[model samples]
Target: MWHELFLIPFLTGLLLAVLLPVLGAYLRLREEWLAALAYAHLAAGGALLGLIGSLPPAIGGVGAAVLAGVGKRLFAARLSGGAGYALMLLGGWAVAVLVAANHPLAERLGHAMFDGQLYFADAAMLQLVVAGTAIGLLVLWRLSQQLLLAHLYPDFFRIRGLSAWPTQLGFDVLAALSLALATMSLGVMGAFALVFIPPWLAFRRAASWRAGICWSLVIGLAAYLLAFSLALYFDQPFGPMLAIVLVFFGVLIA
Candidate 1:
């Protein structure tokens, strides 16, 4: 069961490491916030859904991710990014509260949102892994170069008579998808840190985009390995174990 938790997120992160740069380039989104928002919504929504339903966490996670991505894009079109994110967070919290209130099994619901038990994974979880990997690979293959170009230079892309909007929209969707997969596999902590810290550590050490991506991949995989090993040995939560791995490497690198 624990291995199941590790394998899905590990693979998903590896795929994201390979794909995000290209997607960013094509989308012309210079800021990382787009991806961050997409992932955040997915993590929050997945947790809420898991609390309310018997559906596999991954399914709930993925569905919420998709909804959040669409909702965020619409919100951003009308409002500022900050406002959109705040609204999404509030909405997620409300849903969680409502779900917890209505359920007779409120205790189980609360645990599902905040303290996912990775050791409880079963065959359905494996199916989610397979599905997520497949969808991610397909999207990456289709949009890599466009995303790279767009993110690298939105104004230049516009000057070249290319519209960056489609690329941005595509990346938003991909980010949500990746977040859903990671959240379902490794839970919220795993997804959140993977979205933030790996890129941060890589950017600190790297001077170029390519180099940053390479470093992010190394750091992400190393963190996962270290976290899994520690969790197995100490019987600790995998999320905190992974966080410690990131912090340890981050401090060493600093």
Candidate 2:
């Protein structure tokens, strides 16, 4: 278990355990939590398409998500209240399933994407997770003030003769990258669970916004560690175990 094979995958999951919940906290703040699932589904679809096209799955997945994030700005007015994200989720799911049904390899890859292949994660995944985490934290730190202002005081930017387009676009790309990478590592529902569950509990229980973020990180990290151990011990799939553990944590706190 302590070999390089397990150690690398564990480290990959560790980075994501911390990163996904932080991203989730911000998404929840903006009332855009659906972006997580949308991006995950899209990444899964892109990954399957990539496998068929002989492109690197990560490249395909990330490329598709980044494109959607950038393109979202164009349709922002027409698709209010997450309707666009919901559409993306449904479209991506349909594409992935259709591709899987038609292609033998895609079918196997689709199961892996949904069920997760964390124990088989290689050093390349660790590198990607490490890079993604660093970039995500840096972007979040630099844009944190603007992001809060944009959400909490929507008029603040408009009143100050500032366009929040750059900030919104930057964060959208950041979120797309984070969710796509997480979906690849943790599977669709597993990644969405990490993004959805911990921040949810924190929002209800924490005293302040910053406190909610802190509590979200703590809950996500704790649940991820427990799920990793249990899944290994029981010889079960890690993704479902993670989602289950997170829901159980939510139940306990609720």
Per-residue CA lDDT of model 1 for 1-254, tens digit only, reads 33656555445444544443333332223455445544644465665566566765556767787777777676776867466666666665566566666775644644543443444445565566566657766776676667666555557777888777676677677777766655554555655666566767777778886777677767777777677667767877666677677788878887
Q: Which ranges in model 1 have alpha carbons more than 4 Å from their true place?
A: 1-29, 33-38, 41-43, 50-56, 101-106
Clashes of 1: 16
What's the lDDT for residue 244 in model 2? 96
In angstroms, how far off is 93's CA in candidate 2? 0.4
Q: Would you list the C-alpha lDDT of every candidate in the order shown?
A: 0.60, 0.91
Kindly state the number of residue pairs that clash in model 2.
0
Provide the TM-score for each candidate, comma-separated: 0.78, 0.98
Q: Residue 55 error for model 2, in Å?
A: 0.0
Candidate 1: C-alpha lDDT:
0.60
- Model number with the top TM-score: 2
User: For all the candidates, what are their Cα RMSDs to the real structure?
Assistant: 3.9, 0.9
